[model samples]
Target: MTQLKNLLGFLWYVAHKFQRDRCMQSASSLTTTTLFALVPLVTISINLFSLFPEFVKVSQAVRNFLLANMLPDSASRIIGVYMNQFSSHASQLTYAGLALLVITVFSLVITVDHTFNAIWGTAPRRSWPSRLLIYAVLILVGPLLLGLGLWGTSLVVSTSMGWAGEGAQATHSALKVLSLLILASGLALAYYKVPGRPVKGRHALLGGALAALVFELMKNGFTLFITHFSTYTLVYGAFAAFPIFLLWIHLS
Candidate 1:
């Protein structure tokens, strides 16, 4: 009972800190920024995926996984329309158009950097040149890495299926675990590196785990709400995804 009380007290303190930091305001700003950035980010990712024809299946798998996990059914169709619109135009983009896309994506990255710096109580955010270089690398490398992971998972599942007839369920469970681990690792790295000041590994790990756990619960809970009770469709009409995404970003 004492331990439970201590845990509750710690959580309350954390909630107070979060409220004092004005994270909801920052999240609102980020949601708007992300809405603008989404097309550019998707365009760039599609271009990246096009580079490796052999990983086409992996790219599709990742896309399907994300669509399944991230958006509720009511909002997914609207989100898909925008995604397809961006993807269709990616191949036709001229050099100048690509440059604009890069700038837009980087704007989102910079905003995130500022948010993390503020959370860490750091002053005078990193120079634009340095931030640009880092963000550029992340933008270019992250999707390729994700595709590779999905490809690897596919191979593992195939091999397991061939070796053991009953391995499909096990493979699916393993892949789910792998995906969670990947999410946790990315969160850990973000928490550790985004802050201007150096953060302890344990602190970063704890933060990352907490973030990932909350994200998972939120995703499931939000989906359940959408499935059973949400009247967002009626409220927002055909453009329901916009508001749903905005709310999800703030929740995240």
Candidate 2:
């Protein structure tokens, strides 16, 4: 009974920490950035789902959905155009989205670094020249960084494919293991480079790697828990992804 109570207390602490850690101070900017992120998120989510098998099963139904209840004719037409484009050559769209998403994410990453720096008492000199330099670097290098990150992911996936006979999930556990670290490295680069502070890449990389590991473990654990234990509405089932992803980012 004592152990159970302690565990519950720990979970509550984690939830509270998540709420506090989320970059809510930059909410308006974050929302705009998230909107920008949506294109890539959708692109990546669709591709990953098709590869993962779980999402491919419902893609047709999902497509049928937007086609049915679309509001304005113009909006519907745009969606139709997007869908057509999406189905024809997903890689092109994914690449485009990946390019855009990287810029958006790096912008946010810099903001996070600035905010954290300010809060942590090591705020950098943000003179006009330095600020301009930051903007220039962000605009020029952000997309390239994103492209490299995506290429790294593609390499892992390709390597996984050569080993697996049919299923795309045929990669070794080791490959799955390295993917998180690779992603963390990209994030660490962004975090370290974006900040005006003197944070070293090694420190940011370690922090990012730890955070990524916990986030992945927690995400999978929560998914398994929901699949095995909980039940929710039939109509609004798909939005579960929102809360899960949001919570992970918040907490992580």
Candidate 3:
């Protein structure tokens, strides 16, 4: 237990220090890494389009809001193309998706490796055999982990919906609450999983919860911003808005 505590402490230390450099070095790497890392996430996006109009609606609202508020005057032309990346759902994980995933993971791994290198203040060096082993693990394990997570999330929702009584119906009303947790969990995992580090479970959970909280708050805040503050002219301007959103995420 003590050892676990120490490990958690160390993870927190690295993450805490990360916040300082996030907008500077770490965030920059993370932003680049995440764009690549998350291309795979879009594989699910296509299926999602058929199932959830609500999600696309909310996402567009967010996009429209951000485009208006944050982007500058010069970037308006590229808004349609840029927003497409966020909204895109290809029919299959074509060569392009696979290519994007490969590049993304490669970039993500390198960023993490450097982040760990900085954190431990050690030379960013590894034996080729060891490096290959790690690479093998990531390739094999990453898909399994992601699939497992999706399955687990599905089970949770299933179990909750199984409740049949009147009191349980009230509990059913809180399905979104479960979604809240899952979203946060996703964020924490993203934080833990993105970098080169092998984060402990406790630290991963903690970080995920925090990330989720921040994301939720931003969701509502951004929602409010869109509904009240955003206008047609400002919303359509892509150049100014996209970078600001990227910058904000980098900070996160």
Residue pairs in steric clash, candidate 1? none
The lDDT of each candidate is: 0.77, 0.53, 0.54
Tell me model 2's lDDT, rounded to 2 decimals: 0.53
Candidate 2 or 1, higher TM-score: 1
| Order of models, best lDDT first | 1, 3, 2
Candidate 2 lDDT over 1-252, as tens digits, reads 999999999999878764675546545455555444534433443444355454453444333332322112223344456656655675555666657656664565456556665444575657757766766565444434443444455446656564555334543343355556555775677567655567776888887887667656765665566567546425448565444444434443
Q: Give the poorly placed runs of model 3, Cα more than 4 Å off.
A: 1-23, 40-101, 116-208, 231-241
lDDT tens digits by residue: candidate 3, 1-252: 999999999999878876755536766777777655643433332234324653444334333333433232223224445446544644446797667666665666666667755654455356656765776565554444433444444445556564556435644444346545656665566555544446687887887887667765765665456456656437557554655545455745
Model 3, residue 211: C-alpha shift (Å): 3.7
RMSD (CA, angstroms), candidate 2: 10.8
Sliding window of 10 residues with minimal summed lDDT for model 1 = 67-76
Q: Global CA lDDT of candidate 3, please?
A: 0.54
**Model 1 Cα lDDT, one tens digit per residue, 4-123:** 999999999989989989888889889888888966785577568766787677677667556655555645566677778888767888999888888889889889888888877895
